[model samples]
Target: MDQRKYNIYFHTHTISGIIIAALLYVIFFAGSFAFFKDSISAWQKAETHAKIIHADYNYLIDSLSKTTNLQGRDFDFYLLNSRQGAYINMSASKDTTISKPAAIKSKSKRRGQGDGAYFLYFFANKQPTTYAEGYDMGEFLYRLHFLAPLNQIPIRLGAPFGYLLAGIVSFLFLFALITGLLLHWDKIKANFFLFRPWSKWKTVWTDMHTVLGVIGFPFQLIFAVTGVILITNFALTTPFSHFLYDGKQEQLFEDLQYNRTIEVPYSYTSLDKDFDLNAFVSKWEQQWQGSPISRIHIRNFKDQNMQVVLEAKPNPSQRFAGSGFVKQNIATGEVLASKSPVEDANYVDGVRSLIYHLHFGDFGGTALRLVFFVLGLMGCAVIISGIMIWLVARNKNNIPLYKRRFNFWASNVFLSACLAMLPVTAFTFIMLKVLPEINQAAIYRVYFYSWLILSIYLIALRNPSKVNLHTLLLSGIFCLFVPLVNGFTTGLWWWKTWSSEANGIFLIDTIFLLLGAASIMAFWKVRKQAKSFQVLLGK
Candidate 1:
């Protein structure tokens, strides 16, 4: 490329890098860990720490029926067997009769509302153990990736703003990735294996950034594109529904569901006390055979016009194929609408499923998730090093310190954000393990406050490099002690958990221990670099 074109590409890359570096770092860091959400959740919750054993569906149905009168009411039963242990979540709402259309609309609306009055029945021993509401550690970290940026905004605006910000950042990330490739097109092959750690700081950072970026290019692109699709879908759904669907959001939903429509109106009438849930289960089992039932949604329960929807477990081979639905008429035991299994899903349905699975890294199980996590951290490294290279280039070009004061401040904020993330996350884990009884709201408060306090302290220092070093040291200390803290508080020591039913907890503890050691090493390296720089400056 000519000088002018090269300069334009470089400028575009740098500008985009600076604009989204911090946000990208935050997203990648938190999201990488989200791959192990269920494991982390199990690790955090004492009730779910034991080895998981699948519960008998017959027993589950019978127990739920006896405990909670399952006739003519809105209720759901969700089954899962993962690192979090095999459990059934049963939820029921008070009886309310409405017209069929109204019931359908209400169901759609309630989808986004919180899961109400749910009980988790764990199948640890031969008998079932029940756990009510508790803090979900996995969900907290997962939400931080996409929702933390909007925490301070008002609820009405915050959600949209969060989705918009995620979408915009994803778009710019793709732009930056393309520009970076173009700028280095000629050197791409050579740079793929290049790493000059012993060279000048800027040169070293440039090489590291290039190598990591190229290595994780495919994963990064997948994440970026899927992220754009997911976030923008949520952000723009309302507007699109207004313009394209005649202001009916339900119509948009119908279009996405392959234009399938359920217009049957509910004719409300009291039902007999002997509602045959066993028959419903039997029909479902006959249809799906070996496939485990993941969720069961019953609308207008106990009423003659009740509708039951059963969702089968996701197929692992089909990345995008989620649970298939089988809707039934409760009054007659007749199948109303049966969506094809995910394995045989067609174009539209498959694409929708693929988007969700890819974005969430839910398809490949633990091995794939580990690959994603490592690549995600490398992506974080790419962003951080790209910013450092820019700052270093600015210093080398003799940019006036006064004129670049704002840039300097922004750089500090960026570094503060990047460096503080790990420490804040580690601290949150420690807090959750140590205070298992804490409320959900309070757990998040601890997370946001710890992060905010550290960030403010770093920014107040007015020295990005110094702040980075200090934060690294602090983060290292916090991380290094995480395993010990977990053991002390939970009494589920790593050595003891390995051979027990709590292997998930054991794995989590081991990861934390390794991370702590890495943090400490990073702290030492940063401190040495700082000392070397001070000597060079004759400080």
Candidate 2:
């Protein structure tokens, strides 16, 4: 509360917030939608998660076996992102001396065709699709939350540049939040109830920034910490692994329960009995009824020493945080190791699950996720207001003209980048329905290119009021078109989807419609107040 401490806190907070305002806005805006990632994916494909049947792994494996010998190959089936399907990750056979399975050429540009590849197999359609083909706006926005697209940038920073940058921003965001809280510590209680939307721009932005920042502090704090932990695991864990585990990073990961290695020798002799994957999976599923099987790994394929590893995580609603792992020998039906997801939970499981659930809002279902999404958007509001406050605070006669100009330019660029995302995202969603192609490349091109064009245009305007108003107008139009085009293309209008009880698909249409309505309402209000809101700060 002292003057010296207050000034330090104020300066550090301002610097950090300004440094990360734009990127943090992207993270919040994209992450808010990511809360509905599954719903968005289901909506795009016109499929209901509740209605779609679970994957028919047996049929998929059988179909795959016909194409390539299933023997001696290692297989990993992941249901983490499965929607009426399973992910198949087939590895080359462990027995190098034996004849290998038929090589399936990878259709992706990332890697060459070898003895293996991975793809999603939809049981409803009875077909397979590569990850790129299966990519949807849900995945796009989810990955965009942490700037995954930035990974394509040719940069080396001793780690993935995108992830490393995201982590650094997250860490700095935490510092800013702490400093901001401290700076306002004396007036926190009084400011908690303050609002002055009709006041001068500076006071209005300052009040909004402080009030919302305080209100969303805990929520954003959780996100900041978990985000750093999630994105910077490489940077944070490396030193500890090097020291404690003697550079055996794998061992450190195993100890933390992040990964487990079940080693089984590849016996040359083939198994005499048939390996029934369905029966094996079904048996475990039945035994662990409430806990979902997260992953299944088969090593050595049909060889005598083949082992099947089943990893399960307790449903958040059921037990919150537990890991279940069972490794069993296929040839002899012998259980080599086992752990109960509900009963055998540990400290690591609790910490890991707590972080994931808190960050993701997965514990309380759709309603809680909606609350989280609203708070995320509120976080976006706080960042914008903070930036505006920074600009307005520097727009005084005492400030140097050049310094004021720099501040205004900084705010202009940051706001342009941040606000452009709203319309660009809605535009991309509309494109998803109308475009002929719907793959990763298509999504990337549409979203990024449109974003660039719109951002450049906004920056050219040089007027923050115009930039804000125009983005709102564009966002309103595009967001409204999202549900309309989706209805026309998929024949699943609001009423029809609601009647069918397809909650997942219905939720997507509903959210976009609401967003469109809100954007339009704000646009109308802003247009009426354009003259007053339009502050020529630098000028």
lDDT: which candidate is best? Answer: 2
> Which candidate has the top score in TM-score?
2
Give one digit per residue, the lDDT tens place, for model 2 in 377-421. Answer: 999999999998888787777988888888888899999999999
Clash pairs of candidate 1?
71-302, 72-301, 72-302, 72-303, 73-301, 73-302, 100-266, 320-353, 320-354
Listed in order, each prediction's TM-score against the native is 0.83, 0.97
lDDT of each: 0.69, 0.86
Candidate 2, lDDT over the whole model: 0.86
lDDT, model 1, position 404: 59
Residues 1-539 of candidate 1 have per-residue lDDT tens digits of 89998998888888887998998898899899988877887778644345345445456557655544544346556655452333333333334432211121121222222323334544453344333233477767777687554755654442566666777888899989888888888998777798977777778788988888888888898998989887777565788988898888777977676333433344557655455665776667677755566666667666777777876755554434644678887668788878756555666666787787888776687778888888999998898888777766665336665545656667777988787888898888888877646655767788889999998888777665677678777777887677788778778788878767576677677777877788778778777764332101111
Q: Which segments of candidate 1 are over 4 A away from where they belong?
A: 47-72, 76-133, 148-152, 155-159, 234-248, 258-264, 276-279, 282-290, 317-323, 396-398, 529-539
Instruction: Check candidate 2 and list the clashing pairs.
Output: none
